[model samples]
Target: MEYFIQQLINGLTLGGIYALIALGYTMVYGIIQLINFAHGEFFAAGGYMGVILLSFLSANGYLATYPWLCLSGAIILSMAYCSLLATGVEKIAYKPLRKSSRLSVLLSALGMSIFIQNGLMLTQGVYDKAYPTIFSQGGFDFGNIKVSYMQIVMLLITILLLILLNLLVFKTRIGKAMRATAQDKTMSSLVGIKSDRIISLTFIIGASLAAAAGIMVGMYYGSVGYTMGFVPGIKAFAAAVLGGIGNITGAMIGGFLIGMIEIFGAGYISSEYKDVFAFIILIGVLYFMPTGIMGENIDDTRV
Candidate 1:
């Protein structure tokens, strides 16, 4: 029971990370139909940006005593950087192909992904950098089950963000516009909605969320690498698909499910192949329910 509880906590935390990143994929797909393959790189960019900001603060004596303030600053900076990066990608890489063929946009997305990856490698190097520990060392224990403060924090962050996203998508005017645009770009434009603006906003929101996830992962793991986004990115993409692409709620559920599967499969099956577990589940899901858990909603077809 203790082992089970411990693993559950770990899985939830991991799922939270995947869900946040997966939201980016789903949102982009929901609004523009473009996969935004470079999104994973955006996640990496956020982590690297946080690391740089934290290092600067530490070196400047800004974080010498006010650790919380430094941490807050890093988070804010990381989010901001991610928002700009996302908006820039849309304006530069994707906007040009908005009227082009789907294949053209997809190819551009792939190229953008490679470009960002190599750009980071050249700038930050290929080695892993140690991440600064922001949270105090400790964990709540119960009957041999231990839950780290970082895990709790990650879960809370994920929930808070999820709530915020839900409200934004369901309760706001912009959210309605996004949905409308998703349903039919031509109709949205005819109804006085600027599809381009909605699409850009979608990218911004998605990128910012992914950035938060990246920063949280770096802090939890104590280190980060340029390529860290590759596996996680793929997994998050799978989670989006598993939950049903373009479905926000489905993305959240799928992320948690994937997390549980990966962690439990590692514990019960083989740790060596734990990572492959997500893909296996993905294949099974696709084979049986290609529309995914929520079923693809034609109301909001991918752009």
Candidate 2:
């Protein structure tokens, strides 16, 4: 039982991170029907930005004196940086190709992904950067189960961000516009909503969330690497598809399910085949539920 509980906690932590990244995927797809392959680079950028900010604080003697404050500041700054970066990418690479063929936009996204990854390599190098040790240590124990402070922190932040996102999408006027735009971009524009602006906002929100996940993952794992985003990005994209690509709630559920499956599969079976298990489960679920666990049939009128 204790072993099960331990694995469950680990699953939740991993799932939350995936959920964060998946939200970016689903939101972008919901708005534009295009997968921003460069999305993962935003995550990588955030991790790098966080490490840079945290290290700067430590050098200035601020991180040791006010650890939490420094961390919070780093997260905020990294999120903002990613948001701006996303906005630029959307405007430069995506917006122009919006009216063009889906294949063109997809190719552009792929190009952007390679460009950003190479940019990161050029700037930050291929070496892995280590995170500060201040927040990664210590944890509460329950019998034979152990949970780290970083895990708890990651979970809390993930939950809080998810709640805020739900409220933003469901309760706010902007969310209403977003929904309207998603349902029919032309109609929404005719009704006075700026589809372009809404699409850009969607990218901004998605990138910011990915940035937050990147920072948390870096802190939890004690290091950030330029290549860190690719595999997680692919997994998060799978999670979005599992949950229903355009559905926010579905993405969250899918992310958790994927995370749990990976953790349990690794725990009980061969660790080397954990990823294989995740894909097998995803395939099985999709085979039965073609629209995904929560996905609706996407028609031409949509997005």
How many pairs collide in each candidate, listed in order? 0, 0
Q: Over the stretch 1-303, how does candidate 1's per-residue lDDT look in tens digits?
A: 778888898899999999999999998998877787998988999889878887788788777789778877788789999999989988999998889998999899899888988898999998987776656368898879888888888899899999999999999998899899988899999999998899899999999998999888888888778998888898999899999898899889989989999999998899899878878888898898887887575454742
- What are the RMSDs of all candidates, in order? 1.6, 1.1
- What are the lDDT figures for the candidates, one per model? 0.87, 0.93
Error of 1 at 46 (Å): 0.5
Which segments of candidate 2 are over 4 A away from where they belong?
A: 300-303
How high is the lDDT of residue 256 in model 1?
93
Query: Highest TM-score, which number?
Result: 2
Candidate 2: give the clashing pairs: none
* Model 2, span 167-199: residue lDDT tens: 999999999999999998998999999999999
Model 2 TM-score, 2 decimals: 0.98
Instruction: Give candidate 1 misplaced runs (Cα > 4 Å).
Output: 298-303
Model 2 alpha-carbon miss at residue 212, Å: 0.2
